[model samples]
Target: MKTFKKATDPNILKHVNALDNGEITTVSLKHIFHHGSSKYPNLFRRLDVTEENLRTQELASGTSFAYDVMGVNGTGFKYEKDNAVEEFRNISMNELKSSKLDWRDIGKWLPAIKNWGTLINLAKMTYNAYIEMGQEDWYDLGEEYSTNNTFGWEEDGIRGYVFASSDNKTLIISIKGTSMGFGAGPTVPRDKENDNLLFSCCCAKVDRTWTPVCDCYKGGYSCDKTCLQDSVDGESLYYGITLNLVNSIYHEYPNSHIWLTGHSLGGALSSLMGLTYNLPVVAFESPGERKAASLLHLPHPPAIPWDKMNIYHFGHTADPIYMGSCNGFSSSCYIGGYAMETKCHAGIACTFDTVSKLKWSVNIKRHRIQEIIDNILKVWWNLFKLFPDCKNDDECEDCGLWEYIE
Candidate 1:
């Protein structure tokens, strides 16, 4: 007869901590049962049985208790049969070459414009800023912007704004930044007054990839047909510059982690980059472009591997962009939640957080960038710690599923 132990024994935490710290190599059912039986005999008694019988009993229980303690038989704890990483390696090298293919082809398929009336007003604001700033001020502003990175003119007639840190490990390709919506300042404030506008502008890029490829727009719709026409042309120019930046990065850092991020209009473009190039993204409060892009037959997020990507959305709860049914789709639609231990997917991962209610607002803002970097570091640390014993064939080899994967 199999013996059982109490789970609540003080030694349980000790053993768990040891497993976490890599201090123990092989833990047995006996030790786990001993710990459980000592504290919770009612729970541990069920474990005093054969492995096959226990598995069957757990499944037949159909109670949350079994699932909470022992993972689902064929789903959660079971190892992944398909080797996604190995498959990605093979596909990435040949079919998904980072170079040689024109990602802009995918960009061209997006909707030309979404919510045009909102976009035209944004353009008017930008044009007014250009007029107020004057030529010298405009040039000076461009210079200031360029100071953060070099400016490059692409063959497709669109100018590029490339920003790289001194270490050159990270590169931000602003295919179309704030300047795309309105030429100069007072550039929309980074706060609420300008946040919606910024988001609307980014929707243009999403439009380019996901929106309909049609040239006609009837009046009375929320979108501006005239602005849509202009955006179609603008996206073409932006795509050229983006491709140039991708090429530049390929030459500059052959083996560095690359992330493409953008706000509002830039977010849409960044999403396109992630989809077309298979590069990972960190987009902020971006609207749904995938719906529109899917209309153009563009691939969805599931097509991409989960490990190489994460899309983080920092949304202010009151932001108007998330309120309405933009792109003919409601914003409040709920995708099912995942277990914390499930692996993430390759495509978009949306995380929504209300920025106004945080306790440490000031500290968080000042250290926001560093906080993100630190979180990423912690993820890597935990992954290494947990996966040390994981062999290539181990189930769910990756440490945890990120938002995107879930």
Candidate 2:
């Protein structure tokens, strides 16, 4: 029986100490996600692109008993789920790859559920994926800190971390997001390449002065549909690399319940990975990947509907990137060379009304994962007693004005 009780606040120092002392089990995942200008693989796996907007019902809300799993115990956060959705929760990578050939005819991928405690824990794990050990360990580190030996996070490295519960019943894969602005590092250029490719309406084509990331732009608001599709499926892209990584992790722990979580670009990748393999995901402040998903032609369940999908996007309103308003020539994202235009996220969106409830103004600085973790989630109970409403982004749309031509 899975019982989640009220969880105590996570102690960052203790967790870090345990990790360094080998008390906490952790795995560092390193991969070269991108190839140089000419080293990219020539083979591309394409999914038949399709436009879909299948409306479906949501699961009923409920409360979970806080159960100890990762050493934290307390009354679990609010949740909603339908037991019927469980049967479709797990899918093999081979099955997914084969099904992608005719992705539109695919079966369900996620359970109809959302849990606040699970989401918060996933967020903490994602936060830990960003810790750069000796560099920013003291930069407001709490609940989750870095361990140089087991969980050392590189500011500019394209890597992931795997955490296994003490009992080995559950495993978590945390992917690192772009490390720019907060800490500009070696991976900034490649990270920006992916951010633009995945989120931008065209290819980060903002204005006349901006250099488009790909050749898909065909002057004006027109973009080559085929070219754009090919651009995202490149093996060197982070999505493909992360896909392989997740597949490997899944094969290693076939029977364990695995989850994916990340912030910003990492969050977007996590959602995409969840969509592909039908794993549960909790993405924080992720830009809408619907456009990228559409271009990639990833599979979608025909009967189950989207709200029932297990992926949950948890973010506040003060973030322009997550809100999809961080564009235009004068915006901070433009100045920083980021094209975070896609706003409609996949699965369910659990957004905190920070603008109205907390009286916070929308700002790019708020896009930082640390801001969400330290300023908001840690003191959530004091600020609000219950989790925000989690619902489908049925009305959300992306790149409505841009025209993709064949």
Candidate 3:
């Protein structure tokens, strides 16, 4: 700890000071190296880290995109698997093991990167989250996560579920997106009675409903800005409810860590909530959440490091929702006539493509969380074999245990 020094850049130093004073959360620390580099270029140059070293640093440092998670010749995204059973089966427990060298090493998590089972399970949980929202009745879930887990579940009216097992030290918060089956209009009614927990959206007549308020989230197509506040972690009423739910669960299970998963709108919410709490987050086929990140005044890329607050953002080439298939509003719709930047995608992204056979898939079908899962299942072979195998423990040891299997 003594080896680390205060950053020289004032802007970054401010956040670091806030972090020390507990004014801001740890999530604010992600991608914080620019401060050091900007103010200490000479010192940085003297340190002499090579590109190879830099690439290696990123896998565990959370500085690069998902594609860079595993170096061109390392673990993480560079890892791969085959079929559901085999994908989870042959993986060595060694891959999930953690080491001191890894920066944001979550010592005992099985779903870090290459763990297909965890990814699939979370994807399934995303489905359960949807089912929790779409089903007219609470108990109508099918092949979904059980509400009967050890500590049972907490339903947010129709917003999401907090799955907890009394014996386990980690809890999962699964969120549901825009499609509410029981609602009258396609749009989510921001009624006071509902606590404004849902995004104001409608699955039908989407174009006419006029969504997409931001760019990258581009063009400022705000879903619901009124429910939000003016400071860090000050999310809309929806996430406020989620934050409380998570806090209550955390209070009861004081020793547990939190994991978040969701699809579409839920995914976006998870990103926001995860950032708010500095928890590990994995979202499927979700849009870039600029507004949410705005509250934190998120720094440039790598705002939340994969090693610290791990976020795995999975998207496919065919998903138009996140990839801007529909595009955002015109410049006029944004605040101050300035189009909002939609590229506020946090963490390491795990973006890939599954062939979309349908003509409309470029915009719709492919964006489905199920479709992304289906593609992963369909192509279950290890993806990162392009790199050389680890000859020994020293060559491959890192806190994050992901195999770069080809």
Candidate 4:
């Protein structure tokens, strides 16, 4: 049986220290994840991203504990039917790649700029990501203002969607979050007849065929760096889609301001894609993990080219799903794995201080995208309603959800 451990416990403190050690980076993760594997095998097992193991954990937990895993893999796998439609005129832009963000300058500006309009746009995208819609749904979203969405592609192992403003100026690409499905991210092992090719992690890739440090899902995470590289390499499911999207977009949109957004694991993908595209991104409740060795050129925290790209992460400080805060809370072990050590390195955080109002108690409700959106909308309304013109105009025309007429 699992029991709660104090945050100060030596076993947990080491990881906490390592995560916040300032020196840690994706480069450092190469050492830490493998070297520290022995120390947190149990933690890794709990994080196993496979259908079978997650199913076991869900049954043991007596609830749906692996929803995030499902979101990442289900749609990704379901859509990879080799059906390649040339819908996206620019396949490169449609298939953007994923990269890590510059976390160093994230807080350089102090309190985040509360541009309600940007928040509303991000919130709408978050809603689209959460509800799992296609292009037509976005077109018929019933909003007065103009917004357009296009279905990208689901070939190889990539399943994502794209959208843009009415003028087709500020282009926004959104990836769907982890899907809820019967078989989450699972890999069918390569048998003698299978030639080492297998499907896992929401995409198709060659099996690492190495012994994992901890117990595993169908497709496993192991210390064999070479095999690991191949697992998520060019032929890897998600990255292939991302690469194609980037190639298409880079060639077509020579000067468009590209933006990316997603929630959960989708948020992770958005961050990766933003880095790959070197553009602005807004992510909701993303788990932190290491970039593949091939992306070593990506900059580390405290030294990012802010002028080139900007990233906004809106995770409630109390949400373990965003970062790890479960060391003291036994119930949150699955958050970013058992030790809850997964670390996110996105740009400046537009965080909500949920723990403060709750008297320092943690609640998962703060992690909900809709909940965050509701709060953002409220802040906008309160500020807009304070205007003398807005409040005094008793005969003002209804502006839909806006507090004042445009």
- The Cα local distance difference test for each model comes to 0.29, 0.61, 0.40, 0.37
Candidate 4, residues 29-70, lDDT tens digits: the string is 000000001111111000112346435544664433211100
For residues 127-196, could you state the per-residue lDDT of candidate 1 as single tens digits? 2111210011112211123321323111012222333333443333433333222332322222121222
What does candidate 2's lDDT look like per residue over 1-406, in tens digits?
Answer: 2222232345432222222221222222221121122122221111111111001100111211112223221111111232222222222122322121221222222211233334455666676566432222222111232222423133232546565544445566778887777555656777888899999999899888889889999988899987988898777687777776677667767876676778999889998887767677778999888778767766444433574456888898888888888433337566478888888888888888889888889888898887877777766656776566678876877887788897
How many clashing residue pairs appear in each of the predictions shown? 35, 12, 28, 26
Predicted structure with the largest TM-score when compared to the true one: 2
The true-structure Cα RMSD of candidate 3 reads: 21.8
Among all candidates shown, the one with the greatest lDDT: 2
Off by over 4 Å in 2: 1-118, 132-157, 301-304, 327-332
Q: Against the hidden reference, what TM-scores do the models get?
A: 0.35, 0.69, 0.48, 0.48
In candidate 3, what are the lDDT values of residues 282-339, reduced to their tens digit? Answer: 8887765643454333321232234344566777656655553323432221221112
Q: After TM-score superposition, what is the CA distance of residue 151 in candidate 4 from its true location, in Å?
A: 19
Judged by lDDT relative to the true structure, which candidate is superior, 1 or 4? 4
Q: What is the C-alpha RMSD of each candidate to the true structure, in Å?
A: 24.0, 13.6, 21.8, 21.9
